[model samples]
Target: MMRNFHRWVGLVLSLVLFVAALSGTALSVVNVLEAGRAIRPASTQTVADLAARVQVAHPGLEQIRRAPSGQVSAWWFDGGQPGSAVVDPATGRDFSSADPDPVRRWFTEVHRSFFLGDSGRIVAASGAFAMLLLAVSGTILAVRRLGGWKRWIARLRGPLAGRLHTEIARVAVVGLVLSAVTALWMSAETFEILSIDEASIGAAPSPSGRTGFPLREMEALRALPASSLRELSFPAADDPQDVYVLKTDRGVGYVDQGSGKLLGWQGLGFWQRVSETVYMLHTAQGAPVLGIFLGAMALGAAVLSATGVLVWLAGWRNRPRIPANAPAARADTVVMVGSENGSTWGFAATLASALRSAGHRVHVAPMSAFHPSRYPHAQRYLILAATYGDGDAPSSAKGFLGRLGELRVPPSAPVAVLGFGDRGFPSFCGYAHDVDAQIRAIGWR
Candidate 1:
């Protein structure tokens, strides 16, 4: 019963989860293409040369700064006159001011939070929670179908919906968890409680006065590789007091404007680094394989959602509708049920559709409402409930433990129990095992 309650709630949340996963997949590759196109000539260009080139163009410029994508910023006579342009690595052509598609930004907003801000954050977090539930429910379903968790690893039967759901679930569970955890982490960071902010960094001062013409020297700029740059800040002015601020994947530091001399470096805090990595992993930046993985997970999420609905709808359409005057719960050939949330008198009423149709007057009721008297005319008792968290019982079965102890019945009834669970959990269907043992000890004769 406790398990059943968890199941229905999980089912409803699967819809939102579907959206989150699909959007994540789309985002994984979208920006990758954009990043690839934002190319520049020699990603390793020096602050001095880049400064001179853009400075020659923007005479009023005090300095030149470069973005991660090699976009150059000419900070004019004053920083306020900053002019930006993307520099093509092959041509040194300016492309910095290029605007990415607004549609992509919009899509990002929708994917991240449905554009609701804090509430959107909750939505994303809630979606992660729902995904966790789905993975769990999928595992439970697989274990029960295989007769036991021990059996599930080897001899599981291959029912289409159940089999497909579990197999893909087993393979995709890791990816799903990766995605969910990162997404949740991002959501947490968005809420500010996680505090992923990096500390403020000030570059070391350059040699004061008499700036050398480092811009004309090719060898100095060629010494550094393009990949090392995260972003580069050129000297602030001709006074040579300003150094090159280079933010790299490893740390933030300054470079001597004339000699390319490396300066004081500071690394990012753990939380800041972790947050940055998580965002990249969640979006598959720099690694196409991870992006492909995200896409596959999205595909699986959709498949699981579809099959779940198909499995439920199929059973629903076929389930018998028993009349109120039907024979004793024990005498009826079979029992059937139609449910929404599984919160109704499910365990104490009727267990499920197929079990009720198999020529058995099933004793079905919400787990909390179950009474031994309800099965007075039955010989066999069957319980089909969905398992919730790490094998916890659903809400409908909350009273199962207490009621099982309270009810006294003839010691001749034998029961068969079936449970449903997601395949993403370690303890799938654990609660069902607990329930079955209790039923056996009761000696329902």
Candidate 2:
């Protein structure tokens, strides 16, 4: 059942995930490059110092913003013309154009929303959600295929596509899960579903009718170190009521232009902090190394999707077609198969054909589809069960034990279990043994 769920979901979202993964990988590379090129501010540098220097360079300085990577940019109105540039906190001078790289922007738009705007964002979020499910379900299947967690890195014996898919998943699942979870959180915040907005800072207090206050002398901005600076907006020249709005890692504050006093302050809200952290994790803005690591993992996601499809196709190609398969209600005997990767289905087909040759009407189905209620004429049940991770049931038999326990009274027909697995594993045929024991306990012969 889990295999089916994992396989179908993967197939449905394969293209979406592939595109996201490629775009995400490109963005990650861009992030790391940007981080490398970014200028790190000195610890001693304070927002006041940076603002003062920028104001000196551009007399009509309007705002200063600091990125998580410590890159600073300043915007100003010089000679009544608006201008902006990447500012060096040390020199407070334009070092680079403030304009975003078009290529990076394109990749970002594609990654975040697939260039579809709001609808694209929803689709991206859905892909993230699907990726998460695939990761979890794939993890379970991988562990089971390997026998157990202790054998997590054990040598795998399977077709190339299946082996490659599992190997890549083992290495990339952690990163994939991280990316998926963070992406979902960011998408939630973007859609206002999670509400990361800062708590209201309340109405701005009446400025002390002050104007032309030196930003260097503003107690609020001066006390704020460059490390914590997010943004600082200067009050408009024509508006006496305007104030210096300072946002920092700690919170947001309003500073009186005339007195340079902090008029109002509000600490960062819990949700806002969570959102920031999620953003960092997802974008790797503040963590470039993680960005690169996640990018490699994202590439793995694409590869996994491709290999997963190949594995599915291979399974279908190799699946043995049963002949004259009898209906469950009319069959004198029922043959249930519990297999991963469709291998056990081959055994079921063989058994069904043998029963038919003996003139016994046989119904063949996956163990998960087991339903004695639909087989009233059944004289016996034949179960071909395979053990999965740590003696757990394989994908096809996921709910078989539960269904068996749900029965108020055991079936009167005799039941036989055939176990399949490698003896190299400790739990070899464990699931089949479990089925046999359960059948005996339930009074089945």
Candidate 3:
């Protein structure tokens, strides 16, 4: 049931994921490049120092902002016209235009909202949710097929699509899950589904009636290291009642321009901090290495989607449909199949058809559905099971061994086992042998 759900959802959402993934990968690369090009401030440099130097360049400086990439930008009014530029923290001068790269902005829009605004965000969030489900379900299915988590890196055997899907999923599942979960959280925050309590610093405190205190001498700004600065807004030139608003990694504060005093402070609330951390994790804004790694994993989503569709189509092509199968209680013969990729089902179908031609009533079903009491009218049982990794039960045979073990007594009918596998495999037909052995051990003829 879960396999079907995973397969269908993946197929439906594959294109959405593919586009989002590629865009995200591009964004990650952009982030890395931006980080490389950014002029980082010296750790010991204070906001006061940067602001003072910038003021020298623009006496009407209105604000300074820092990006997670460590890039700085300054906004100011020159000759009655406002201007903004990326700042050189080393020299506190205009380094470049502050406008974002157009291509990067386009990609960002595509990845974040698909250019659909709120509706696009919802669509993007849905894709994230689908990716999350696929990651989790695929992991469980892979673990089972591989026998256990410890054998996660074990050799794989199957069709090319299946092997490729499993292998890529094994390597990229962690990153994919992390990205999906973070994306969902961010989406929730965006839609206001999550109530992140931001501790308020209250309205900006009334500034001292006097102004013109030197920014470099402002106690709060001087005490703050440039490394922690997020943004610093200078008080208005004409408004003596306005105060300087300082935002940093630690919190927000209001500083009286004339008095140079920290009038009010508000540390980030727990939820607010959590949201920021999640945002960083998802966007990889501050962690370029992680961003690149996650980008590679995202590329897998496109591959996985394509391969998953191929695997599903291949199964449909090869899996023979059973016709005229009888109910377990009315059939004289029962064919129980345990196949991983549905190949064993074809053999079972052939066997059932042959038995029906021989004037016998035969019922076909997966071994996982085996229940001796349900086959009271059965005269014989034929088990067709394919061994999985290291003798583990195939997908359809999962739980059959446990169910068989719980039987207080074997059915009053003869039974036979036919194993299917490559002789090249060491544990070839191992599961079939186990089933036969368990049957005999329980006193079944």
Best by TM-score: 3
RMSD of each: 6.8, 4.3, 4.1
Residue-wise C-alpha lDDT for candidate 3, range 1-445, written one tens digit per residue: 6766888899899889889988988888889889889898899999989889888988889999999999999999989999999989878889999988998999999999999999999999999999999999999878866767887888887789999999999999999999999999999988889978666677876667778888789898899899899999998878898888899998898988888899999999888898899999888987889888988898887789889888878877766878998978899999998986778888999899899999999999989999998988899999998887557787788789888889898888999999987664556778888998898788888
What is the model-wide C-alpha lDDT for candidate 1?
0.59
TM-score of each: 0.69, 0.80, 0.82
Q: Rank the candidates by TM-score, best first.
A: 3, 2, 1
Off by over 4 Å in 2: 321-338, 343-420, 431-445
lDDT by residue for model 1 (81-186), tens: 5454555444444555645467667768877778889788688788887776666666665555454656555533334775566677767877887877887788
TM-score: model 3 vs. ground truth: 0.82
Model 3 residue 224 distance off true place after TM-score fit, in angstroms: 1.7
Model 3 stretches with alpha carbons more than 4 Å out: 320-337, 345-383, 388-416, 422-430, 434-445
Model 1: what TM-score?
Answer: 0.69
Residue lDDT tens for model 2, 258-315: 8889999999878778878888888888688898898999999999989989988887
